[model samples]
Target: MYACIAQWIPPLERPRFIAVVLYAIGLGTAVALPMCGMVIDAAGWPAAFYVTGICSLLWCVLWFSIIYSTPAQHPRISREELQYIENAVRSSGTSHNGPTRVPWKSMATSLPFWAITVTEMCNSYGITIIRAQLPTFMKNIFGLSIKMVIT
Candidate 1:
């Protein structure tokens, strides 16, 4: 989904688009973390899970209704916007015949690929630790309730 969005972004705006998408993701996580804690504290852990599940379902529905893999496929887009996107893609020389086959052998030996893999693993580990343990840490170390930690 993100790769599709990246493809649609004009080359000059790609950096800003990626930054904004990442910022939104981080912001959503920040907001949802405390909200989940509060929900768990108030209604119990099951309710928090239910809330999250419902939100996910709603997002899927909205995404299906609103997003297209390409600007040319978007039914609700204005003619001007469609023309702009077509022009941008044409000018960028990024239009493809179809999906290209991956160079599996090259990727397997790539230093940059290994670097990114390791970096992602470390990042996920840190985020998981904080997300899974922060509430307990706050309770034990700071003598704070779940609601208090969230607040």
Candidate 2:
């Protein structure tokens, strides 16, 4: 999605748009997790899953309804804007005929790929562990209630 934004947007504005999108995602995560945790505390873990599943479904609906694959395919894009995207793409010498084939075997076997993947896995695991265990830690260590821990 961010890649789509970066591609359709003007070059000077691309980074800003991508950054805003990333920040929005980060902000949504920050807000949603604690609320989900609270829901778990009140209604048990299954409620959290239900909430997440419903939200995911809604996002799917919105994505399919609103998003187009490219500026050329978008129904509502201005002619000038589409021309601009076409010109930029032409200048970049990158085809919009669909992405070039990726070197999957080479990429999968690459040292840098493995290093980055492992690092990301560890980081995600650490964050998951903290999210799962922190409320208990707060309750036990500081005698905090669920509300206090979540808020």
Candidate 3:
């Protein structure tokens, strides 16, 4: 939502708007973490679920109230702005709704796919080795408490 609005602004102005959006997302997470812990500590885990459910419902209400399917339907959209948006969409060749199929069988037979698959397999093997022995290594090396080991 913010990014779409930011696109209409001047190039220099767009970056500032994007930065603000990113900052707000980061700030929201920062605020949420400690508040979530406090709620969990005070009321128990179920209270956190209740809070999340309420927040989700409120977001749905706000989304339907403030947003429209297209610029043409948005009450705040100006005539010139709507024309600009409609033309931009038409020119971009991105507003189509159509089905497409991926030729995965052909891709699997290709050299590039084989190369990628080999690299990914090597990476997965390394991860598998770590996963297989990590808990035993942690238990022996760190000598963690029994509860910590279980969790």
**Which candidate number maximizes TM-score?**
1
The runs of at least 3 residues in candidate 3 whose Cα sits more than 4 Å from the true structure, single-residue gaps closed, are 1-27, 97-151
lDDT (tens digit, per residue) of candidate 3 on 9-127: 43445568778977886676555545555666668768867876787799899989987766666899889988877666656554444446879899978999999999999987986
- Please report, in order, the local distance difference test score of every candidate based on alpha carbons: 0.85, 0.80, 0.67
The regions of model 1 sitting more than 4 angstroms off are none
| Candidate no. 2 TM-score | 0.72
What's the C-alpha lDDT at position 132 in model 3?
Answer: 51
Q: Cα lDDT for residue 133, model 2?
A: 80
Clashing pairs in 1: none
20-54: candidate 2 lDDT, tens digit per residue: 98799768777777887798888997998899889
Worst 10 residues of 2 by lDDT: 90-99
> What local lDDT does model 1 show for residue 129?
91
Query: RMSD to native for every prediction?
Result: 1.6, 3.0, 8.6
Is 2 or 3 the stronger prediction by TM-score?
Answer: 2
Could you tell me the lDDT of residue 67 within candidate 3? 76
The per-prediction tally of clashing pairs is: 0, 0, 0
